[model samples]
Target chain A: MTGPHGYSKDKDAHLKRLRRIEGQIRGLQRMVEEDVYCIDILTQVSASTKALQSFALQLLEEHLRHCVAHAVERGGPEVDAKVAEATAAIARLLRT
Target chain B: MTGPHGYSKDKDAHLKRLRRIEGQIRGLQRMVEEDVYCIDILTQVSASTKALQSFALQLLEEHLRHCVAHAVERGGPEVDAKVAEATAAIARLLRT
Candidate 1:
């Protein structure tokens, strides 16, 4: 695999955010298992959902900067395909 | 930027799937704008959510087979970090 370039520093920060989100999920699972208040569990679930949407958005932005931009510079249908794909992903994201 | 290797064929397929999902999202938007039945909108939204989850799972599996596995063969903390990141991403996906 080619080594990823261009965002190692920010990648680390993204990883840290993901780790915290991981912990939140675990806590959520325990909440469900323990039969915690339905509303309380739902609240945490909502927060986690938003957290994930935020992360996905961040990754999407980075993809545009790094992957899609590069593909466009090289020139071809690949660029249009990628932009369309990304737009679709964003549409999916907004639905949630 | 480096060209992506190992999944060009599948990548195209993924892009096509995303494009279809994009149309689905647009249809959902129209449904919302037209004030379609609440339950019907909710049902479509749920299907879209599952569709996104499926796409994410496919990408995650491919990443494990390609990226994470290659990083492991190369040897070092990079693999571990990647695996941790992937696990966290999976956790977030499940919460949804």
Candidate 2:
């Protein structure tokens, strides 16, 4: 049997994006090490942040479409739990 | 004058969260190098993914509240551009 939510169909894509983000992080480190201008470093940081955010948003959509949608279709306590889980997730995201 | 979006008020919080995520990424790399069990690694990956998503969501909310909202208030081509920019971002996130 599969684990709680099974495996994501887009797992590979997610990993690839993460690896790229890792590289970006290293790039950011190098920029800092080289004493890049304050605004320039900030700009790179913003871009890296956006890339990571994009990756996260894609995963959230997948979770909702696959895990959450599947749990919702089953219709039981799992449905409530899954909905709560997603709601909690969204709440965390919205939290400042 | 400030750059396109000026600067985020919660910039420090965002940086802190991203730094935490960098640690998590490092932890994942260690898990892999150590040759942890497949399922265990996958589980950790899932958790990291969620954490990153939460960070991104928070940033997106901030962009909407500050950048997008400010653009709308100003009213011009900038408003259209900002709306389009946010829409493109959302679309990117939604992509499977």
Candidate 3:
């Protein structure tokens, strides 16, 4: 299930984390349905958000350490493209 | 910047949060470059990860509340499409 960056090494771990996040989202929905207090629901929402972001950062780190590093070592147009792609991804994530 | 969801109301806030995340990532790179203790680096990584996840969850919530809800209200094939799209997105985020 790896992408072009070959991040599949930790694929299982990533999936597990994501499944938990899905659960968290479901919980948030239920909380809303049950008319939970605003602050309490927001708190859980915060927790869920943190969990997802943590997963993203770890994925990004692996991409940098493995894919980007190898591309840099190869040293050519691919390197420029990889760097640009990674930078753009970072920009996108920040905007997100 | 808002996309179809018209999430522009909080665009400034999202951008600000993302800028902070960009700084955190940069700080992480510096930490690795400086050979910071592995445990300490991991701790900071955890913090940064949490921050990013929080952002994502919030974004998803907004997408569901504003975008998906509106689509559902319209009541047509687009409603199903929007729900499917959102579900697929959740699946992707979880896999990530």
lDDT of candidates 1 onward, in order: 0.69, 0.57, 0.60
Worst 10 residues of 2 chain A by lDDT: A1-10
Docking class of 3: incorrect
Candidate 2 lDDT by residue in tens digits, A1-96:
243332354455656776777776666555444444333444444566566556545656766776778777887889887777667665544441
Q: Write the per-residue lDDT of candidate 3 for residues B1-96, one digit (tens) a residue.
A: 124343446656665765665566556555544544333444555565566567667767887887778878888889887777767666654543
Query: Tens-digit lDDT track for model 2 on B1-96?
Result: 243332355555655665676777666555444444333444554565566556555656766777778878988889887777767665544441
For A4-33, candidate 3 gives per-residue lDDT tens digits of: 343456556665665666566556555544
Error of 2 at A10 (Å): 20
| Chain B TM-score, all predictions listed | 0.88, 0.84, 0.87
Task: Compare candidates 2 and 3 on lDDT and give the better one.
Answer: 3
Regarding DockQ, does 2 or 3 come out ahead?
Answer: 2
Off by over 4 Å in 2: A1-20, A26-96, B1-7
List of chain A TM-scores, every candidate: 0.83, 0.83, 0.88
RMSD values for the candidates in order, in angstroms, are 12.4, 8.8, 15.3
Best-fitting candidate, measured by DockQ? 2
Please give the lDDT score at residue A24 for candidate 2: 68
Model 3, which residues run further than 4 Å from truth? Answer: A1-6, B1-96
Q: Tell me the spans in candidate 1 whose CA falls farther than 4 Å from its real position.
A: A1-96, B1-7
* Interface RMSD against the true structure, candidate 3: 13.9
